[model samples]
Target: MGSRQLESFVTERCRSGTLTVTEACHLFDRLLTTRDPAPTIYPFNHLFTTLVRMNNLTNHYPTIFSLFNQLTQTNQISPNVYTYNILINCCMRVDRIGLAFVLLGRALKEGPGSNPGVFNPLLKGLCKDSRIHEAAAIVLDKMPKLGCTPDLFSYNTLMNGICKMGQIGKAEELVDYMVSKGLQPDVVTYTTLIDGLCKKGLLDKATQILQCMISKDLEPNVVTYNALMNVLCKKGEIEKAEELLDFMVSKRVQPDIVTYSILIDGLCKKGLLDKATQILQCMISKDLEPNVVTYNALMNVLCKKGEIEKAEELLDFMVSKGVQPDIVTYSILIDGLCKKGLLDNANQMVQCMISEGLEPDVVTYNALMDVLCKKGEIENAEKLLSFMVSKAVQPDIVSYTILIDGLCKKGLLDKANQMVQYMISKGLEPNVVTFNVLMDMLSKKGEIEKAEELLDFMVSKGVQPDLVTYNILIDGLCKKGLLDTAYQMVQCMISKGLEPDVVTFNALMDMLCKKGEIEKAEELLDFMVSKAVQPDIVSYTILIDGLCKKGLLHKAEQILQCMISKGLEPDVVTFNALMDMLCKKGEIEKAEELLDFMVSKGVQPDIVTYNVLIDGLRKKGLLHKAEQILQCMISKGLEPNVVTYNALGCTAQTKRN
Candidate 1:
């Protein structure tokens, strides 16, 4: 075949993703010895460049470079800057920066004869490799010397590199230089600086630069506004960001995909998911397509807010729109499903990703394992762990923590400990959540000292104790009757700037009540209400039960009424305690009244409620009322147990006397 025919064949094969680099080179070699020698060098250079672009030169760099050198030696064609730049880019892509620089030195030494096109690719390679300083030096030294004036693109690339390096001062200096050279900073230029400042968390500085850009009569483009909005939203200045967005719309700077993404992410972070959905709808109305980042941000927020159904809907919408779901999208849905205890759905999503030819990432495995663990499907979680390892997907701390927590919650403390040991053996450090789970499990088993010891160990390991850590330890100590110790822990949590949540307050109150310190429990309850921490059902129940046990029926009744006034309904246990207290106090009428009130309020009385009333009536020598209640209980499909029989027999004996 002619040399052109060979080149066409190689190009076709490379584009097909089926040709090996070696085979392409071999075909090139055969074509070079053909009768047609004129087109040989260009075809070979084209093949080598194609290989570099295709990212198929991993183990064949030396071969490609040697072929280029051979083309130069035979003088079939001279090697230009494009060929060398392509090789440099290949080196950078493979993280071989040193080799890239060697190519750079070769290009620079090639002097005025070399094509200045080399500088563009070189700068791109250096910037991508985070060698921004080197790239900046090249831009300063090479472009002018080659008589190649730096374009707007070159300046933007340099500025972007400097900004990403967190050298905003240097980036500004370059921007000023670009303007002084009569090259005005365009939207790309300002956007880069704004993005850099935002990334470094200098929102005010970013805003100032944006204002400066606007003052320069250079309108803030979509990118400029999007960057500022993203930073502001991230910094929790969503309102101000929205205001700027309003300005953007008024100025006719149409919001792009990124603009919508920034606002969506911001709203989601602020728990304004409904607003986020609105922005997403607006984006679609504007004909802007929601990208993967946009969908992932929306999915993440929805999942976190326990809006799993909406999140799933979004996932389907994204798929129907032909926006491929990345690992992040899958992971978000998996975590949301797991959190909602939908393990089957979560697993199906994972399998779906795999079936779509996307390998499950570590995050996918971790999320699935977490759901399985929470569902008490420990065996399935373990199976997933093994599958993760088998598939070479390394398990992270989240994976192990999920398993440990599941085992601990299932009362498999020994297995949990073994897992902890396994994590340590594998050189993976346990995070705060891991230790919290273990300590909570130990505390529930009444191993208060062990829980405390683990707490100390966690702190010693430099894992800062968060609110959860404190709450678990305090709850454990309180449950073990170590009220003083638990209270001390509460103080420590406050000292650390962590406020006690309602759970902490309730635990403390319950501890005090169990110790017969009803007055202190009441004080705690009052303090909790004062703190604006609305007492949950457990809080009211504990205090009410404590007062009732102390024969303080009036106080118990007052608390019950207070709970109702506060929009908290009493549970079955609460009603039973109240009835028992009233009956024991010889107020059978009041006890029956409370039962009627409970039923009237649509609170179904459990068997315990009826038994308490029946026993109380019989004890008060109301034999007819007691017998009527027994028959009423049987009619209600509540079988009379031994307590019921005993109470009835006692009433019958008293009646016979």
Candidate 2:
């Protein structure tokens, strides 16, 4: 047969999907040995495109690269534009865009016949990788030189890329550029900007763009409505999202699976599970099938509400309806079961996942490990870690962190430190939480120097300590009575752009109050106010208790008035401190008046309240008043504990003497 006949046969076989690996090899041999001397690029380009298409179906993207290399190196046939386009597409799909660009440069050098078809794939690949700047450069600067002008698709691709990167302003500018070039902005262009603005919380601008699109007579598609609905749902504007859904149906734009999924997820998040389920039913009635994501949303909500059995039933229901359960389904159920202390059932879930041929991912293993660690079953958690390694599933930093936290909780600081070193050896740099957990444990054990060493190590490893880390260090230093060191640490944290939170201020204030440094504590309170950090109830309580202990009852009373003026209602602890002070001062009638005030303020007196009053009255030899207070305590349904009995017992002994 002639070369043309052989080429035609190859094309027919490739197009019909009848080309096997064995047959492909035989056809290449015929092309190579053909007596036509110099072959046209037709056969080579045809074969390459065919191979790429077949690989795409099977997800064998790497195979396309290997085949392309073999054809170029072994065969002396020059490739055409079609061949380059197919190879660029294959490279892009396999995340080898760098290699795709190299082929593109080669194509540009060969010159002419390069069009939007050749360039659009590269634009899309770059856009998908979030290389919007590079993609825009190619369209504006490179396209004109290559004799390939930018089209509406080119502008759309770049705008979409920019929007995804949250540069909505740049996307809008690109749209203006497209319009200036006499290219009309379509529904897709408007939708892309809307989605980006919505994600960036610039919903007003997104709405304006939607209005502009409508004015331009560009009818919004399902995708456009879906994007807006998604944003509204996320913003917790369920009512607005529902109105939009109604409007979409009124306009006869059919709601797809995504529309229902978004609405269902929104309602579920708002804790309206019944409403979410009704949306699910409405979707089914409309002949739309619920996918794994739709079911996963419901299952997640059920699990969170502690309705695990209902979630489990939903899982079975989905499976019965031919919807396969994914890793997320099992993970949610496992987490729920673990929280409920159903470790045995959670283990069974793992086994069930494996039995269904779904290999448990790191997330699944982490969930199980975290539960075991919390239960003080570190040994069992270690065994599971080994099992994960045996299955060739690499354990993530989360897995190690869970184990470290477990060891720390069990007071095994040495073992936990060793685990941190092991994590480093495995090249999994400990995150801020990992370091914070270790530092917190070490500091609590009176190993402040060791905790500081860990902090330095974390800095050396390029892990910036977060607010939680600073708070932990501050709390630890305060506990150890290292006030100067703790103060210096707070200064350093503030200088590093970390604002001192309520926890930090409270820790310092508490330490000062306890050390009788009332002056310094008051100054700290002033500083906190200047910094706009409102003093909480604990702050005022600390001051009141400190003043009362100092025997300055008048000052303490004034502070209580100030706390109440600031809208910080004194709690039971605050009242107990004042009552105890009054009883000790032999002012029993004044203490009784304070008790009446507490009751008027709707603060029920606890056992301590009654005990203080009864002890004071008994000490004053007012035995009848003490007896009346005890009877009132009994009437309030408060059963006296050992402390209450001891207080009354001491009073009775004094009376007998």
Candidate 3:
């Protein structure tokens, strides 16, 4: 074919998606052999652009790069600025940003010095990889050297990236820098800052930025409003979110489907499904069709409330409305079904997802695996994991973690360890939560030293020990009677800026109580209160039981009264402790009065209650009263256990004696 004919053929083939990469190379060689090469850059640019449009850059880059190399050998065609731009974007898409800069040098040496479009892709890639500091350096340092003057879009990209990295402070500085450079921040810039601030829980600062945007006549769009509303919703400030929604409407910035979806999601998260439903209806009334996200939000709430039938009905309603369910939709339903112990329905949902051509992603498989693991079907979970690999849907960290957790629960530590190794081989670094799960299992199994070693290993691997990690370690050490080590660990937690929470305090107090260090436990309780760690019911119950066991009934009663004074109503267990102490002291009248008090407080006595009261009355030779108590226990629908029968038999034997 002539050069012109070849170029036309390639363009048409590329447009029609009929040209393979190899065929394009053959056609390019034919064009180069022609006396006149009919602008090979155009055909090459078209092909590269087509590859980008396919959104499969990582898969296609090798094939396209091979063709580029062949054309370079011939030296019959040179890539223009457009060609470089396409190539730079392709590199960014695959996170091969370093290659993008090398190409930028080639473009600079060739012709048409690099521009923002070339560098923007690099910034995007860096931001996506959370390399925001490097991205900023490129914007502020490298771009100027390349004669690429960073524009508004460039600054906004950097700002958005910084915000996503959770460095809202740095983002604000970037905004200031943009202002100093005379590059005006637009709605996108302000909205990005607002989102970053809100996510950081600096909602007041976010509101100030929103107000600043309004003052600049930027007139916050639906995106800006949605960002603010999303933050408010997540903070459980539903009233504020509702007010913001009303303000957005009052401002006449016509709420889009995304705006309504954000509001619905916020309400659903706050467990206000009825309000979320109202928003859905309002959106429908306004002729704004609810998308899959909107339906998924409602369905998630229904599933969590264990209203699986209602969730399914919402799914049907969505399908009827021609809103197709994505992987998230199916995953939500599957998770809900699994939580409700309807494993069969969950599996059927997976099948339905497959039948509808919606391939179950890792999340879908994780849901199934999690259910199987919880049900003790560990072998079945492993089979499903193998199936996931066979289907080419690579198991993620969550998938391996689920199986590891299941195996650990089933006491298959060796197999769980193998799965961890397998995950590492697959290049998946176990996250802190995954490490925590394994560590928890080890600790519970009395492998304190192994658990400690694992903790150290996770730290070396760059997984920062969170509160849960320290809690697990401390709990394990306490259980092993390594109380001094556990106490030192608490000091380490404080040094690490992790304030001891109620769980941490409870663990310590329980150990002290067990060791009969009542005075020390009391001192620790005081210290915990001083540290602003309010003692939970578990903490009080532990102390009360400890005092009662030591025959310090008055002290235990004092603690009980203290709990009540703090507005903490004693549960049946708490009352039972005090009653057991009184019964042992032969304070039969006091014990009876306490029982009446518990019943008046609506704390229904259990089998333990009847057992203690009957034993005390029988010891005092009140066998008739004890029998009457047994009749009352039966009438109260509390089943007496062997302890109750044994105590009554002792009373009869004593009466005969």
lDDT (C-alpha) at residue 280 in model 1: 90
Q: RMSD in angstroms, all models?
A: 5.9, 8.5, 7.7
| Local distance difference test, each candidate | 0.84, 0.86, 0.87
lDDT of 2 by residue, 1-657 (tens): 898888888888888887866576677768866775555668767776677666443465665566667667754676776778788887887788889888888777766336666788899999998888799989888897778888788888898889888887888888888888788988888988888888898878888988899999998889888988999999999999999999999988999999999999999899899999999999999999999999999998998899999999999999999999989889988988887778889889989998998888888888889889999999999999999999999988999999999999999988998998898899998899999999889888988898899899899989999999998899889988889999999999989999998889988988898899999999998999999999998888888888888888899999899999999999988998898889889998899899999999999999888888888887788888888889999999988888778877877887789
User: What's the lDDT for residue 487 in model 3?
Assistant: 92
lDDT of 3 by residue, 65-174 (tens): 67667766777688776777787788887777778888877777866456677667777778888888898898999888877789887898888888888988788888
* Residue 326 in model 1: lDDT: 90
TM-score of candidate 3 against the unseen true structure: 0.67
Q: How many steric clashes does model 2 contain?
A: 0
lDDT of 1 by residue, 205-276 (tens): 988888888888888788788877877888899999999999999999988888889889999889988898
The better-scoring model by lDDT among 2 and 3 is 3
